[model samples]
Target: MSPALRRHAPLVLVALLVLYPLLPFLDWAVTAIFGVRLQLDRQIINVMIFAILALALNLQVGYAGLLQLGIAAFFAIGAYTTGILTVDKYPFQLGFAGALLCAPVVAGLFGLLLGAPTIRLRGDYLAIVTLGFGEMTRVVILNLENITDGPRGLNPIPEPVLPDWLRDGLDRFLPADRIDLAAIHWIVLAALVGLLILMKNLERSRAGRALVALREDELVSGCMGIDPARTKLTAFAGGAAIAGLAGALYATNLRTTAEPNTYDFSYSIMVLCCLIIGGLGSLRGVVLGALVLLSFDNLVSPLLTRALQEQLGHDSTSVFANFANWRWLIFGGALILMMRFRPGGLWPARKREVDPATKADA
Candidate 1:
C-alpha cells in the first residue's frame, strides 16, 4: 500500500461502508447489462450486527483474556428483553427504542450475576462455567413458554420509528419504499461506528492497561495494586452489554425475537470463530471477520445453492441443492488452516516494545 493510502485506509473503509447501502440507487450501467441486481443492504446490515457481537467477544477474550464460551446467553437476554418489552402480546409495550435502550443494561446485570461468584475461577474452569450458563440460559428461555413464546418465537416485534420531522426530512431524499430498510441500515451502521470508537478509546484507557496486565499475569498484576476481580468483572459485563446491543438490533432487523434455539451454544461458537479468524484483539479484524463469515453464510451460500440448482435443473431434494449445509465443514477446514499457519490471527495485536534501557534494568 502507498504511504498515503495506508495512512487513510480506515477512513476509506468507513466511507465505503457508509456508501454501500446506496449502491442500488446509483443506477450503475453494469447492473442492467448483467441483469443481476445487487440488493445487498440486508446482508450488510446482518454483517454489521454480527460484527458488533464479535467485537463484544473481542473485549472479553482479546482485551482481558477471558474465555467466554456462553456469549449467546447474553445475546438471548437482549433479544428476549426487547421482545418482551415491545411486543403487543404483553403489557410492557415500552416501544422499540425504549426496549433497545434497556436490553444492554439488563444483559449487563446478568453478566454481573454470572461473574460475581465465578470471577475466582480461571482458564478451563471458567470456560466450563460459562458453557454451562449458556446452555442453562437457552433451556430457561425454551421453558418460558408464556413470555418468550418458547419454540414459536415472538412476532410483530415492531420496527423502530423515527420522529415525524426526521421521517419527513428523509422522505424528501429517499423513496418511501426504500426508506425503512435504508434507515435500519444507517442506524445499525452508526451504532457499530460508535461502538468502534468507544472500544478504541477504552483500549487506551487506564482500565485497558489493567485488563491487559491481568491477562498477562493475574497474580503479578494484583501485586502491582490491580484488582483482578474488578477488572475481570468489568470486562465480562462490558462484553455482555455490547452483545445485548447487537441482539436488540438483530431482532429489530428480523422483526422477531426468533426461537430460543436461535441463541444456542453454536451461536457463541460462531462468534468465537469470528474472533479466531480475524485475529483476537484487533477492532478492524473483528469487522473483517464478521463480514467474511456472515456474508458467506447469508449471501454466498444461498446464492451459490440457488445458482447450482437452477443450472442443474434440480429440485430442492436433489444431491447438488444444499450447498449451505457445507458451511460447517468449510468453517472447520478454514479454522484448522488458520491454526496451523496464521496462529497469531489474520490481524494479530501489535506487540508492545520495551525500551532497551528498561530491558537492561530488568
Candidate 2:
C-alpha cells in the first residue's frame, strides 16, 4: 500500500468508530441548532437499517452479479417472523432474542427454498422468477389474515432485551420507556458494521473471487470446478439472510409489522435503485446509495408534499397531496440521468493490484 493510504487508514477507522457511537448525539445537536424537535435519531436509524438492506442486496448484485428483483420477499419474511415471534401471538411467546436469531434463519431457509429450484436459471429469466416470487410472498402475507393479520399488520411487538450493564447506562441517558428505539438503533448499527466488515473480507477471499468469476462467465467458472448452481444459491441465501435480518430489525424498531402491501414491488425496486445508483459491486457505493435514497424518500418527499400543498393553497386531502405518486417519477429521472452520464455508479469500485516488479523498480 502507498504510504499516504496507510497513514490515513487508521484515522479513517477511528473517525468512523467515534461517529457511530455519537450518531444520536449528533442528531440531537442538529435538532437543537435548528430548534426542531423531530426524532432525528429515529430517522438516522431508519436510514442505517436500509443501508444494511442495500449492502445485503449488494452481496448478490454487486459481488455475485445476481439480478434479484424480489429481495423484499426475504425482507418481509424476516420482519414478519420477528413480529410473530416477539409479539404476543397466540400459543407462542418467543422472546426478542429468539426472534432476532430465527428471523434470519427462517428467511435464509426461504431463500434456500426459493433458490433450490431457480438457481439453474440465469439472466433475465432468473430476475423474472425472483420478481414473481417476491410478489407471491407479498400476496400470501396480505391474504393470510388469520396468521399475518393481513392489512392491519401486527402491533405491540416486544423490544429486544439488552445486557443489564448497557441497558442501565442507556437508561441513565434516555427515559426508560423510550430507550428501546435507541437500543435497537445501536444493535442494528453494530450488526451493519459487522456485516460490512465480513463482506469486505469475503470480497478479498477466494470465495469472493469465485463469485466474481462466476458473475463474469459461468462457463469459465464451471470449467474451473466451481458449481454455478451452488455458488449462486449460496449468494442468494446470504443476500436473503441479510435482507431478512434488516426486516426483523425494522419491525422491532417500528414496534409493528404492516400488511404484505408494505413490502411491495416498489420497496424492492427502490433498494435495487440504491445499489445501482450508489455503484454496483461496491459496498461504499451501496451505503452511499441507501443514505441518499432513503433520505429523499423519508425527508425530502414529505417536505415536497407540504410545499406543493401550500403553494397551491390546497387542503391536505387534495389530489396532489401525496408525494409518493411523484416519487417514482423523480427516482426514475435520476436513474436515467445517472445511467446516461455515469453508468458505473457514483462510486464505482476500482480493482487493486500490487505489482512486485513496480515495487522493486521503486
Which lDDT values do the candidates have, in the order given? 0.86, 0.84
> In model 1, how many backbone clashes occur?
0
Candidate 2 per-residue C-alpha lDDT over 1-362 given as tens digits, one digit per residue, 9 for 90 to 100? 89998878745853564355434576668777755455666777788889889988888888889899999999999999988887777557687788889999999999999889988886889899999999999999998999999898887788777788878877776666556665676688788788888988999898898999999999999999998898989999999999999999888888898667989898999999998899988887888898889778777777677678777774778656779677888788877987799877998887777698998898
Candidate 1 per-residue lDDT, tens place, 1-362, comes to: 99999989988888887776556555455346535654566767889899999999999998999999999999989998898888889899988789889999999999999999997897889999999999999999999897789998787788877678878877877777566776778889889999999988888899998998999999899999999999999999999998999989988999898989989888998998898898888887888899889878866787788788887774778755888878888888877988899966788777779899999999
- Any runs in candidate 2 off by more than 4 Å, and if so which? 1-29, 32-37, 314-323, 354-362
Clashes of each: 0, 0
Q: What are the clashing pairs of model 2? A: none
